[model samples]
Target chain A: MRPSATWRGLLRPGDYIVLAASIALCIAAGFGLWRGGTPDGLIIRAGGEIFAETDLSRARRIAVPGPLGTTLIEIQPGRARVAADPGPRQYCVRQGWLSRAGAVAICAPNQVSLILTGRGSDFDSLGY
Target chain B: MTHSVIELTPTDTDRRIARHAAAAIALTVAEAAIPLPLPGLKPGLANIITLVVLARWGWREAAWVSLLRVFAASLLLGQFLAPGFFLSLGGALASLAVLAGAMRLPSRWFGPVSHSLFAAFAHIGAQLLIARLWLTPHDGVFYLAPILGGAAVVFGLVNGFAAAALLREKAHAG
Candidate 1:
């Protein structure tokens, strides 16, 4: 193999350590999932509402007021999309819809939040 | 043969540079292709190529390939200057620095697989830092999950295998 051919060779020791730190992230994500083990749930906050309630196979196009501004969110049977408007930015619209449990979209700037909680599954709040 | 310094002709050098640029760009594209259930999480697949290039070619060349890749990816994804970009940059630079230090270690102590695992961990660490510093700071510290760390280990191994495939091709050609 060429000198640079070794993919692992290209990485330094510190790289491994740095990458290992993601273990923490993984743990947190898993914890979020574990504690939130039920399907069909809802999370209401100051920004907006996030729910993972029904089957995504029969969703339809729905207009919504995002925190940043006006948006057209497509709620498909199993997917959702946020359309961009004349707001300051449309990054959130570009984010598309989230399908997985615990998946959430929020426009903090606009105090608008969307969460699709698990469906048919109980909402388990580990603590708070 | 291993003890002697590796030499290259001018043409060979040019070809090598071309290959690195091509590979880096490809990896950058690949990295963007994979999506997570969440907006923030990524497998960091492109870092695999960057890691291999850093290990074999050294930090300077790796820097060139990775730096350009990041900028190009950001532009393509329309995520320039977005929090996502900052997270990626912080992780990448930190990984480079870490890889640079590891290069000094005895080769017998590790293998390509180990190197990949190391880089994966580093990327995650820097990502966390970015999340804390730039992204939402409220309860940001909770972002760390052992599952993500485990994913890094697994993905790093997969990336190592990818780099190894490239190596085999290079060896065959050279």
Candidate 2:
């Protein structure tokens, strides 16, 4: 059967409802997947294994030993940073403070890495 | 020595399905040539053919055209039996399943646009599920949900309009 409506008058009431619902679902997915909260703790890894996981509620210093030397991590309330590293470039130390969820500081030469974790902070993979 | 020859006869319905599947396959191969800014993001131009077929024929014919397009197009693109082939198959199957149910909606209200939107979303949703389960095997794949969802809405509407236009033209001509 030939369609009763043309392209000009194609959108029916159901069409409008579907369109609205699609756009709404898209918006909801964007917000739900992309939005992240502040990080609550920091995880330190050395030699490809988890070395330490601590909350950012108290100020503390963690020294994780790796192949090269000790990598010092300084944690302040709600934030953390790499204080020192034996890695040549000091890339992790230069990364400064990591406060947001999913943030990372990697000392490749020293084989140490720090990652901030919180609700909705999960990441599939991290690249250099 | 004597050789026996076998002959095959295809009925009218078979020819019609072949014709529609050929069109869908052509569009699929053509669409693959277009450069995409992001991985897994496609304009889904072939979906237009599926929507058109569904509107002109029925869900079974549309399913045949869509699945045939996936298989034939993959073979033509030299991606047969590859990971990309499975992705294409998954998306086609998901979308065809959705269209089957969507086709039952009241014609006075729902039409090509609604069916297209539903199929597009289902297509991407299934692809993402497959990628997470088999390919990436990580929850991080969900991070792409927003971008893909948005693409589905946009492309779904565009393809839907294209199908509507084709139906209109055919309606006038026939």
Candidate 3:
């Protein structure tokens, strides 16, 4: 078919329906995400229990008892990190800083973990 | 050897499939080289070849070319049997199924643009499903639907216009 000849025929009412529906869905979803807001604080878990919930805006440090020993957690303005861990590998300490909601750091040997919670953050964790 | 019972010659259709598949694979590789802003967000340039082939020949030809492109591209990218390969395969199969169904729609009512849009949605939707089922198994993954859907709408339109332009050019040349 000639390009010019079929140009007018490319779109039909059904096409408009699909486009409109998708646009509506996109807008609604975007609005929802926007309203969801950022996480307010961080949640710390140790030995499968709630250890602490600290406000992200405040700068503080806490030591939580774990299987191996104490796991020190540090929270600063909009960020949290494992300041120190008694575990041998120090994997949790190596996790560095986590500022975004839904970010998590685990010290498996110490049975201590930190999770960031808030609005707008999606996905429990990322996978390959 | 007195006589050969089976013919092993490459027919015109076979040659055409090879050419189209190669072109599509090249496009796929080239696209992979470009850095993406986010994971699972691509312009899907290779789909243009599939669109054109579907329009010029038929769905069967288009399917063969599309599948061949996926396999060849995965092998070349060294992602065969990996998570990436499975995601690509799932997305391609879903899009092909969508295109096949979209073919039944009236040609005047459904053109390259509509077909592209449908296929794009199907591709992303299938990938997300696979990710949820096998990869992540989390509800959080669905949160990306809005972003991915929006991208699909934009790229679907762009690819559709491109395919249409290419088809027009080929028709004029012939």
Candidate 4:
């Protein structure tokens, strides 16, 4: 039979729901595992007082995150300089190197956050 | 089915060409509905429709519909000649490759249903590889992996059923 260049009707509502749900599930799964709960990329920390400051020209962005609060930061070019201030727990230094999605490292009490946001703009183009 | 006005043309050849183009357009619209933050990679549902056309018609006709759909849609959607446009063009080309491979199979080796799924997998794999390498500027690629893979399986099954029904209907009518 010759191919009928027909306009098949719209997908039934139920079918649309099914396909959409599948898509959402896929996106969620990827983000949850790949970038969920990680913080190595460029992150913002909450500080009542000056805790530390780092130059932005050193970090390299290596990955893309799909969700909230996830990054992978590799500090090699320059170390983030820490400053003495008031907060509580100065655990900021204790937070180790970050390189995976969906993981976070923070300093409690001081309220300083150190996250890895996939591609650090500092060295994005430079980091192949 | 409610085909486009082109199908109502008086000329036979034109009608046939119009019908094929109409289907291609319809499939492209369906593909557009599946949204993602990033462009290029999709479940390749449009390709399944193209493959079905190839199976029902000839490869030449199918190729015409496929290219028209890609070029026309890219222009209409305003992705004309952009990087995403190239990705879609590459996807259409790769899909044709899969369709050719499937058509070469023995008649009884697998039904149209299975063929749709197979072609879908191939299309998704190629698009994924492209996205991982090109489109994704950051960790965003990670988010697309599961979605693309899962969409391939789910939509593949839906398209498979549709293809099988189409083939079965043709057989009975003949």
Candidate 5:
């Protein structure tokens, strides 16, 4: 019932295989899943509708009208943010610089939101 | 009016299962006292008892001990039927499923270490899946996979060694 006369016997070949495979999986996920590319596009939604989809390569300011008022979205060369919103707290404005893929800024009271898109979408849908 | 008495007698196997489950539950309770930075990150010291039981008895006995430990420990920890309880149940089921298969592997090459490692990986994977589907509902939960996987590997190996040593000592004694 014992692998050896001593209790301190080294791991078997199958044990080594499992350990190696587990380490390999850990390394693969660590390196593969975390390197999200910089976002290149931004989608603006207002009043539960798509206001505009623009490329992040351009630097411009777009004002989208909603139920409350216009929410100003400022887009830089590679990032976007809610520069101003009718929402009192300006929580979306505080988000500041949506540069990563799947990054989002929502001005709930203004009914406007901005989402940054990279080479690919990181999630199917997101809500706060 | 005559009252009939129902006799309850514990079988040998029942007694054995209870003994092993008590040990596993003790480990589970003792392990909870140690503080860790993360919520779900546990060394899973109780699983060493499971591995030892599997090595000594069989997978059925191990499964019984494992499941009993989860339920009993949850009750003892006052987390019964809570989110933490479901997570523990999910993990225990997943690890038991893997061990059911791993136990069939050739014992010469695959023993407590291999079974423990595979079960640990399955344990975390199932816990994360349940957390994502039921609790967090966000794919971002997967971002914790690498860190959890690392812990699984380290703790699984350590527990496997502990189980192997216990089995060796038992073999020497018995």
Candidate 6:
């Protein structure tokens, strides 16, 4: 149905004010949340238990005991990665580096996982 | 066993609400069939019926239709009493509250478009709050603010236009 001429008149100054205010609010809040800082450390898990948590600032290499064997994790200045995996696929090793909060890498066969965490990480867990 | 015949006749208002509720529920069910790339993102097409009902029959009838649609849709989708149901319930109640307030504005100042937009934001905002409090309890959930808010605006405009068109058709038919 075509909007009648009166329909266009439905929006008044007050409506525009409300709409503009809400839009601005959303933009501000969204940007502010997006600008949050990066994570500080990585939470490593093996065999469904927390294996270790290492600061991203300190570069180190650690081996975590897993179901299959040891999983090697490397931490750099501001990033972390699964350097090697005893698991068949080496899937975790291929996940590359994780520098941002909420980034995660897992070796399902070895039951080892790494999750980035920091104050800037906004979500507790990711949902698809 | 003895059978007693009983006839229950619904009033015009009841029938109108029933029809509106049914329409809203149909939209909800249809929306569920569409796959969304992200969680907490929906077109909220059923809200169009709420806007139409509020404009035509007032907030009371609209509230009935909206609540009925939520309850019925959850039951049909087998999400009753689940996290999804609570989220839906929270969003519906929050949107209804906003619509109730928005209705106080003069018709010439606020129509379906503005009302729908306000309700859309309220719906998403309430859902986010509920998710944070009960479902996830993480600050990261707020990361969805931009995407969900953007969707709310787009879907709100589309639903509002549809509701306005439906209202015009009703006016013409009457």
Clashing pairs for predicted structure model 3, backbone only: A39-A118
Compare the candidates by lDDT and give the number of the best one. Answer: 5
True-structure RMSD, every candidate: 15.9, 5.8, 8.5, 13.4, 6.4, 7.9
Q: What DockQ results do all the predictions give, each relative to the true complex?
A: 0.13, 0.61, 0.31, 0.12, 0.47, 0.30
lDDT for residue A55 in candidate 3, whole number 0-100: 83
Listed in order, each prediction's TM-score against the native is: 0.53, 0.76, 0.65, 0.53, 0.73, 0.68
> Model 5, A64-101: lDDT tens per residue?
99888899999999898899888989899987887777
Candidate 2 lDDT over residue span B45-127, tens digit each: 88898999899988888888898898999999999999888988999999998888999999889989899999999989999
The reply for model 3, stretches above 4 Å from the true place, is A1-14, A31-128, B1-7
In candidate 6, residue A6 scores what lDDT? 57
- By lDDT, the candidates rank as 5, 2, 6, 3, 1, 4
The total of clashing pairs for model 6 equals 3
Candidate 1, residue A1: Cα displacement in angstroms equals 18
Best by DockQ: 2
Q: Candidate 1: misplaced stretches above 4 Å? A: A1-128, B1-15
Assess the local accuracy of residue A27 in candidate 6 as a C-alpha lDDT between 0 and 100.
Answer: 92
Per-residue lDDT over B11-127 for candidate 3, one digit per residue giving the tens place of the 0 to 100 score: 999999999999999999999999988887999899999999999999999999999999999999998989988988999999999998998898766678778888888989999
The TM-score between candidate 2 and the true structure equals 0.76
Q: Give the winner by TM-score: 4 or 6.
A: 6
Q: What's the interface RMS deviation of candidate 2?
A: 1.1
Off by over 4 Å in 4: A1-128, B1-15, B30-45, B137-143
In order of TM-score, best first, we have 2, 5, 6, 3, 4, 1
Model 5 bad stretches (over 4 Å): A1-10, A40-99, A102-116, A119-128
What value of lDDT does candidate 3 attain over all alpha carbons? 0.86
**Tens digits of per-residue lDDT for model 4 on A1-128?**
33452322323334344345546656777666554432233444554443333433464433212123223334544333223323345444344544443234554454545544443222222110
TM-scores of chain A in all candidate models? 0.45, 0.68, 0.68, 0.31, 0.68, 0.68
